[model samples]
Target: MVNNILPFDDSDLTKMITRQINRSWNFSSKVEDKLSTELKDLIRQMLEPDANKRPTITKVLRHPWLRDTSGVTGISLTAKTSNVVGKKK
Candidate 1:
């Protein structure tokens, strides 16, 4: 998503697979300026080489980036059971 393309090319599938297995694959340098630091950090955490060191779903949800919902607006459906059931429409 960051690069708007796959990190590895289809023509080099074998080499790409080898790099993935070796945990040597990474986003291109070009993406550094294109993505935010927080986003890059989150991506790095998600792609941690060690599974045990990766952030849990809960942790990810609570990350500063996700927690800061300022400027974002959306409808709250918790109290709109009738609307969800098509009763209000």
Candidate 2:
């Protein structure tokens, strides 16, 4: 949908990827002592826009926040169901 809405091609995609990676890194850096090497690299892969180079959904599932499922009842059931369904596929 964003691709359709924006007049972006491969080069623009790369710039957006770079900007997102930098933004994430900056935010993480402010809150933590340092990013683990693995997370830094994974974030790089996550921001990759190339159809082949981006991380898979399952790879993203391994993120630390997703490992915990208890005590987070703030989200709606519909959102939860969509999250579950997205992981299943």
Candidate 3:
């Protein structure tokens, strides 16, 4: 989840909405330093405010960074996630 860092994080709800609306937050130097180019690019694409500009689930799944499935098995929550796995929506 992008290092679990929230670029739009703010204590003020309105400010957080504004930041998300404007897409104005930049990753901090430390976070930027830790990200690879491919991952950064993917995050930017996913963050596009315009829904039409955003990548589809298929496209996201096909991204070079995500395509690396090594050591990644089916998701689990503690080999268990949300206790809602396989639950009917």
The model with the greatest lDDT is 3
lDDT of 2 by residue, 18-59 (tens): 665454233233433555555545655666657586866665
| Candidate topping TM-score | 3
**RMSD score of candidate 2 (Å):** 8.4
After TM-score superposition, what is the CA distance of residue 88 in candidate 2 from its true location, in Å?
8.8
Against the hidden true structure, what lDDT does model 3 obtain? 0.74
lDDT score of model 2? 0.52
Ranking by lDDT: 3, 1, 2
Show model 2 residue runs off by greater than 4 Å: 1-33, 63-89
Q: Which segments of candidate 1 are over 4 A away from where they belong?
A: 8-18, 21-23, 75-89
Error of 3 at 23 (Å): 1.5
lDDT (10s digit) by residue, model 1, range 1-89: 87666755568888877765566766677777877678778877876757898897657765676656577678433334435454543
- Rate residue 9 of model 2 by lDDT: 31
Q: Candidates sorted by TM-score, descending order?
A: 3, 1, 2
Residue 41's C-alpha lDDT in candidate 2? 57
